[model samples]
Every structure is written in C-alpha cells, then in structure tokens.
Target: MSTEQPQSGDPTGMAGPVTDDARLFPPLQGRAVPVAQDRWERLVSAVDIPQPPEAVWAALTDPGRVAHWFGVCRGNWARADCEVMLDFEDGEFFWCRIQQNSAPTADHPGRLRYLWRWVGIGPVTSVTWTVAASEGGTSVTVVEEAVNPPSDWRSWNGMGWPGILDQLAAHLRTGTTWRWPWRRMGPYLQVPLPAPPFQAWEALTAPGAVRHWLQPCAGSLAVDDEMTVVMGDASGCALLKVTRLVDSGQEFPSYLPYLEFELRRPRWPAPLAGRIWIEPVGLHESLLQVFQSGWEGVGIPAAVVERRILTGYWTSAAARAQMLLRPPGAQAPPIGPHGWSLSGGDDG
Candidate 1:
C-alpha cells in the first residue's frame, strides 16, 4: 500500500516519553536526542495499502516479490532462526536477523521484527513492521530505533521510507520498482573540532566563520545572517551568496549543523552549490566538512583545479580554523569521509 496519510489504527504521534533531560537539548522532529540518557533515536510512520492483509504479507515475505519493492530479501522465511540479507543495487546491503514473524490471519493480522545494520553508517537499529486488515485495505506501520546513529543516517533512513513504501505498492500493482541508488560526487573536506559540539558549533556559525576558513572577503557575514562572500584564488575572484541558514536542521542538527550557499558562476552554467556541515564525532570532538557539486552545468569541467582549490584553500583553512576554535593544548582532530576524489564521477 502507498504511504498516504494518517489512518485509523495508525500511530498518530511519537511513542515513548519526552523525558526531562530530552527537553534540555530538544530534538528536531524525528531526530536523534543524544543529550538524553538514550543516545539512539526513534521514528514511526505508517502507510496504507489498497490490498488485503495477505497481499501485503506476500509482498513482504516472498523473496522475489520483496526484491521488486525495496532490497532483495534472501534466506528461508520458514526458518525461525534464519538470517536475512537485504541487498540493494549499488552493492550496499544490510543484514537483519528476524526477531519475529507472523503470517497474516483472518482474525488479527501479522507483524515482522528485525535488527538491522549496514556499513559506512554504523549502529544497529531495530525495525518493526506491523500489518493489519482494515475496512477496505491494509494498514502498515514502520518503526525504527537506533542508538547514536550518524546524524545523516538517522535522517536519511527516516526520510527514505515513504518513497520505498511507494515502490512496494507499485511493485504489487505493476511489475518493477521505480527508484535506484546513487551517491553525490565532489571534492569533500572534513576538519576536526574541539570538545563539546555546541562550542564547536559556535566556531562554524559565528560571524565571519566562512571568511575565516574560506577566503578573505567583503560583506558582513555572520550566523543568523545572510551575506555574500567575495574572494580570489588561482581560479579568479568569485562571489557566493549565502542562500539559506539552517542552524541545526536535517538528520543531525546537534551533530551536524549546516550553512548553504549558491555559487554565482556566470561562465559555467549549471547551478554551483556548497554546504558547510559540522558533525560532532564524540562528546569531546567534532568534524567540519565542505562540499561542492553541480558540475553538470559546465562545458569544460575543471574538477582537478577545483579539488586543488578545495584542499589547498578549505582544507588548510579548516585546519587553521580548528586551531582558532580549540584550546591551546587540545590535539587537532583528523579530517575525512575519505575516498572523495578531485577526479569527478557521474554523481554531480
């Protein structure tokens, strides 16, 4: 069934208590709350299908059928202690151990519970899928909980469901799933920060943060403020407009705060955009990153020159910014999200 909206028997709001400690550093909707005792986050959402319970159950349990919806499911469903694999097209996959599974019945319905995990993004998240027969169709609920997952992961997994459920419903009605996997390619940089992320956050968003790390510039740039950055380097002087400010938005507001800007490149036509992502690595340290993409707008792509610019400028500058933000004796944190090449890929 398609993920339509709130239906009867659906979870109308968040489950679990919003404990007192959780209120201190409030979580963005469907986001992780690290300040609280439980470092993990919880997300609950539901989808309605026009088919009956057994159809939904079949679409879920049958390996060949499930493959058309999301990831391909492998392993024997008949074995109670079997290990199932969910492999996507890009070779990225997750392994899950079936915690519980009930075949759909006339009186009640059915449910499936599994513990899931993947590489790059670590942390085991318990996932639960419940299906019940309703008046005209079936209602399905999906719940995921992970302890201290990477901020982007929490957000990515949470936001990626409805579309998947869409694929499920489509595969049930038609024959094939609609979407595939892809990753953005670009010169990316990550810099370490001092203890306590909030303190590191100040260094990222404080007035002139971009100018401090990026280039010497004109315009009054500051946090909670928007301005233009005018700078020059080997590539020549260019202007960038801070298009939007999201203090702590997306998957990891606390761990990853953001500042977005649009590059005004008149010569190269495609829209050039950049993002400054601040990610807290541990309670004592954080990582700052810079990324640029949208090279498809250009006739002659100078990605090598761009990589030199990113590493030569931002990488070195981010190191300097780290010193500026950290205490004198504190060790400099490492940089990464490694394997990002100056040489381009199709993901621009």
Candidate 2:
C-alpha cells in the first residue's frame, strides 16, 4: 500500500516538524528488558490478524507465501532440523536452523522457532513466531532475543516490530504487501581537506561560505534554529532544522565537533537527518565527513531514483567544497563513492 501523502505547494518545499499526529502506524509497543540477569535482551510485539489460524500458519510456513511478505524462505519446514536461508535481497542472506515447528492442534496453537544468524557469524539468536486463535481470528506474536543488545535496541528493533506487524495485517486483510526489500539508503562520504579542521568546519557551518560549494543558504545555523537552502536560480527551497551544533572546544572537548540537521521537504515521506563533522588528520590536514540517512521513503522505483539524485547532489556538493579548499595545481583525487568530483546534481 502506498504511504505517500498528497503534496501541497511546490514539490520541493518546506516541511513541518514530525509529530505523533502524522505518524502512519500506531504507538509502538514492545520491551527490551534483559532476560536472565542481563545476559540476553528480548524484543516482542503482537498483532491480531483478521484471518484464521490455518491461513496465518500457511503464511508463516509456506516458502512462496513467506517471500510475499517477509524474506525469501528456501527450505522445507516439514523436514526435521531443516536449514533455511532467508534472503531479503539486501546483499546479505540470513541462515536459520529450525529448532521447533509445532503445528496447530485441536487444543493448542502452533509455534515456529528458529536459530537465526548471518552466515559465518557467531552468537546466533533465537526467533519465534506464534499463532493462536483469538476472539476474531488469530493473534500472531513475534519474539526475537539476543545477547549484547545495542544502545538503541529499544527504539530501533523493539518499536520496529509494530510496523512490521502492521504490514503483516495489511497483507492478510487485502492481499497487498509493501514494496519488496525496502532497502535502507544512507549515503556516507569523506573528503580529504587541505585546511585544518576548524576551517573545514567553517566551510560547512557558515552560511556564506556554504554558498560557494552547496546551494545559497542563509540562516543562523545555531542549535534549534532553521535554515533555508535555496535551489538553483531560487527555483525552490527546503528547510533544515539544526538539531545539534557541537563545538570541539565545548564541555565535551574529546568529542568531534559536528552539526546535525533535520532536512524537511513537502513531499518527503519523512524528514531526513544529516550531519557534517570534521576529523583532524595532522597539523594542517583534516577529513570532512558527510552522512545522511532516512532515504527509504516507501515509494520504490520513484524513491530509488530520488535517492540516487539526492546522493549525487551531496557527493557533488562535497567535491565542490573540497575544490574550494584545495591549493592550485593539486591533482584531483580518485573518483568513487568516497572521493571528490565536480559533477553537479540537483537536490531538494
């Protein structure tokens, strides 16, 4: 199902702050509490699907059907200790070994358990899919637990399950699955700078200096302030809300100074977040790192093209900034995802 909302005003326009009222999914529910004295952490979420247990069981076990909603399952569930490979078409294939596959009986529900791990990776985790008869049809629950949880485990994985379950519910009710393999598109670039870290930081944060490399931008880029970035010839503009402006000489002197902003556009599915920071290399050299995430906007083919254009713009922008800082007669660096180039691209 399409999640894109209708656009108003210019397609490349300003955006409002993201609020709970604009969220597409329900309030996230789940826990990341440690189990067994901090040895392992669990993420769990449940949804009541308006379908029979038998249908839900087939969707969970059938390889072809599972591929429709989740990843491509390539093994027989009926076989004892079956080894399965779940390929989500994202360059990585997850290897799973079935630990339990109890079919639904007259008195009880069904439970599918497996040991999940990346190929050649250690510390495999456990994943369980349960389906039971509920008031209307079936209640499906998913649990995944692993050791050494990351710092954002609660907000990332724990809250993410509800959205996946929502997708599952949509698939069962209307036979419509979202765009397959919703790839995450976060482009990262690092450019070697001829100047020191402070100079490079000024080229990034100073609105007047930024005009030479990127589009003409005018606004106080302080924390909690907003900046207006004008497109070519002032065709359109976008707003960037400065979320952070960390200085190296601040209280946290050990931390690298960085500027983080929330990019807003009228037609975007969600606001994208980006950051620019300086890394000192030597007495007179530094590296400028630019990274932006939240590119998967749920509109597959169009989103893919949009992402490439956006990435190209950022890449070219960094290249321009590097050129502005480079000394005359300096040879150009290699052209790659991380290198500098002067080719221009449009941005929203």
Among residues 3 or more apart in sequence or in different chains, the pairs in candidate 1 whose N, CA or C atoms overlap within 3 Å are: 1-49, 40-147, 270-297
lDDT of 1 by residue, 1-348 (tens): 867565455576332244555777665667755663335678777888889998888888888787777776666642356776675543235667788888779887788888865521224678888889887899888888865555565456646467667777787777775445443344455445655556777765565665555454555444323344322333554456666666654445253467777655445455567887666665676666666666555444564454444434444555556666768777655534321211111111
Runs of candidate 1 with Cα error greater than 4 angstroms are 1-37, 74-79, 152-154, 158-160, 177-348
lDDT of 2 by residue, 229-283 (tens): 6432223555777898888666465566888888765566577788877776544
Give the clash count for model 1.
3
Candidate 2 lands at a TM-score of 0.45
Relative to the true structure, candidate 1 reaches a TM of 0.46
What is the lDDT for 278 in model 1? 68
lDDT of the candidates, in the order given: 0.60, 0.65
